[model samples]
Target chain A: MTQVSDAPAKTRAQISQKTLRTDRWWEQPAIVATLLTIWVTYATVHVFIGKWYWVPQYHYLTPFYSPCVSGECVPGAASLGTWFGHLPPIIPYAVVSLPFVLGFRLSCYYYRRAYYRAFWRAPAACAVREPHQKYTGETRFPLIMQNLHRYFFYMVILISILNTYDVIQAFHGKTGGIGFGLGTLIMLVNVVLLWCYSLSCHSCRHITGGRLKHFSKHPVRYWIWNRISWLNARHMQLAWTTLGTLMLTDLYIWLVAAHVFSDFRFYN
Target chain B: MSYKAALRVWRGDHGRGDLADYAVEVNEGEVVLDVLHRLQATQAGDLAIRWNCKAGKCGSCSMEINGRPRLACMTRMSTFTEDEVLTITPLRTFPVIRDLVTDVSFNYAKARQIPSFTPDPSVGLGEFRMQQADVERSQEFRKCIECYLCQNTCHVIRDHAENENAFAGPRFLMRVAELEMHPADTADRRDIAQDDFGLGFCNITKCCTEVCPEHIKITDNALIPLKERVAGRRYDPLVWLGSKIARRPRSTGTPKVPDNRH
Candidate 1:
């Protein structure tokens, strides 16, 4: 073993000087105004004009269900419209995106590090910075937005099922009884993929699993519980996946809305 | 793509220190610590690095990568873009030695200061049984790997160094809460938690939970509950009245908060 020495020695008071300079540039009125405007405009447009069609309309290229008569099979026909019944609606999209956007803006990693730089450690750069200012009542208005995760989980599950229906509808495209479109299938795939990603989130898992202190020792039930716990263990993966899929879901819809990608073909 | 990464090694000891930069070539899978080790082995043999397991299981490899408190082994080189310069430094809560290693003895000292578990042996082994629910409550706390990421990320300690003497931080509060909730362990750490451990300092920002590599809910589970217990003593009118009434000349209420610091 290499000889370890107490070469570095300092009193607690002495180490306090290692504080570093942080930036509050984002808090500047101009920057705040610009960010608010962009966010507000995006929300307003997505809510009123876009009509949440970006997620539902472009979902067209997935195979969900096939009518199989034992060894024999027939394709089932179901359009995206039949599955979703109607568009997801713009008001709900705006209501949902509003908090998510604000949550990301008001309190996030960037602003956190920014505050750590500006306030906690000041006038010098240190390896360990001081704790940023405690956001006392901040947990109320913006942080309460986190509570929306429960509702978001429901949306994710619903959208996923709706998308799964679309995928199944693709496989059963037997006749013109609302046969599946590739666009709707893609949207369906998008929802299912994102739903798998979202449902397995840490917040969701904790909301469900973490609250449970005891369960009857039934091997069958315990097995299912353990599976959920296992999913919770990989919550970070789910977090990243949900983030990615949400973007993809929006992009697929946007391109179709803009007529950038005119046709989305399922079979190569 | 190969990018020129800066290896800012702390050359001098505590008083005299400077961020000396060494340009090094980095690959996709190589981590910040990997780059540092390469620098130490080839470029600066005398460079000081406190690392045991590169797998991130041991907390020995904790350092600030580009001004973020992350386990060096877990940090991938790919996280940084080509044009970015990565600043590597020792943990802030502890004092730095030569380079990336800091004095983590503070954690050990704090741990020692907290009263250890004393099982009520009179109850006898197998005599005491608790519901699976109560046991499970503390089980989540026992999962703490003691990475001190919670300690490091805790604003009470990370920002206000003075709180170190009084406050136990989020990590140890979880310890106190674990002990307090234990069925067999018959010691009261509430007062000590309030005064000495500085449980009130934690504003429940959950920065500790967020930055935790182990992802323990130090704020939600441990610290908040401990604070509530302390508040029960200090403010809860009903509990305060009960404690006051139970104060017979012979009957001492809960054990006085134990002296934690040696």
Candidate 2:
């Protein structure tokens, strides 16, 4: 009979240095942190400001206040009738859909990597040590809620439908005829990018073709899954691009509503 | 067209280490491993490095060249500027065994944890059949060379040592993904993939894919599909209710009779 013994576990190299990577490993996480902070701050302030979110002339409603359900919403802005009475200023105008939108992005597979690296530093980058001694990842209570991404995805689709409706409504001319302006173009672009981001989602790809044991039996689903997989390959890029477009659309609407400048009207 | 290339190779063991610089001859069309081989032959013959086949296919000479995880056998010397100094280091994710060689037993341990392909016992060997599309779905992952580059580059285990116990890194998870997608594999791997193998830990950063010499879309094709499958089993309420109503018991050890109709 051969005898076997357990060997002592080997420890990592104790070089004292944090990381031996000579390259600028901090650059990516730093840039992500800066951009996400600016966007989140701008969004939080704007969501609470509750003013200059709607341009009544051209039916241009900022995404920040779309489906404006509160009584506090300005006249003509609450296209989807005000469902709630006047409330505290802390609450956003599109309170009904905002949480789901936030949840959708927050639980996104791509965004999860972004914030996990930038905010949590569960690892800032590959080969770089994170600050935390222990990492539970999304296996625990709060992080485990990330699994609810599919549920959040469903809600965001409904909100996006409302956003599409808002864009369609934004085609109003000053005299009630068809209107086409820079705001219309911006909102249109924003909604298109929004759809791209939503459709390219990992959850969307899975829901489309994941559980199917055979691809040949379900040709239509297989085709759709292939398209979604192509889009899903660029989910990270779409995730960031939509963020930029969302902010750009809102900023344009805000500026127009505040009379910062008139909408660049091509036809009215 | 040979030139004198300056090389900085990390020299040390598990306890401590530092970069030792040397000037070596680099011939045209040569690779980083070639220069290292010459260096090992002429000077510093005692220097330790792991390599075999000297070809990229073997996935043996994996190291960080200029801070990127790559197969040294595949990296050409001409990619860098003439004046640039080539810095070679061992994979950061594993404990160093010697100079440029890391103890990759972690991957072996992870590989051991995964249950082998559990084809239905009723289906005789060599009698199993599968659709070409289904075969192609997992063929991408079959190209893995066990380089451990993906395992080394994956941030879940690369940075977080504690995560080693939970996360199996991209390579093994890709293995699980491949087996799970196999038409004949009757093992119910969704729960183990989530609970044991740590599929939830992967954030789909594509680092594994980027480092893969095989270019096996480890993130997009394998990990994400596995995640969706796991989500179908665990998260989707309708799927859960359907399974329960259908009285389909979650099988663990026993392989289910293969359903050829799929």
Evaluated with TM-score, which candidate comes out highest?
2
Residue-wise lDDT of candidate 1 within A1-268, one digit each (tens)? 1112222335221333343223232244344345445545654454445322432332332211111111111112233222222334433323323444344323322333333344433211223443444322212444334323344454445545555664554442223344445555555656665555555543344444432333333445444545665765555455445445544555555556567766454442
Ten-residue region with minimum lDDT total, candidate 2 chain A: A1-10
Candidate lDDT (C-alpha), each: 0.54, 0.83
Summarize candidate 2's per-residue lDDT along B135-251 as a digit string, tens digits. Answer: 887888889999999988777776676677768789988988888888788888888888778888877767888889998988878887888788777877877777789766544
lDDT of 1: 0.54
Interface RMSD in angstroms for candidate 1 = 9.8
- lDDT of each residue in B1-262, candidate 1, tens digit only: 6777865555665635667788888877888778888888778899888888887777788766665567888789888776666766666666666666677777776677666876776888778666675577688888776667777766555665645666666777888888876766766676777666666555455567766777666665666555545544454455556766875232223444444344
Q: How do the residues A153-248 of candidate 2 rate in per-residue lDDT, one tens digit apiece?
A: 899899999999999999999889899899999999999999999999888888888666677778899899889989988898999999999999
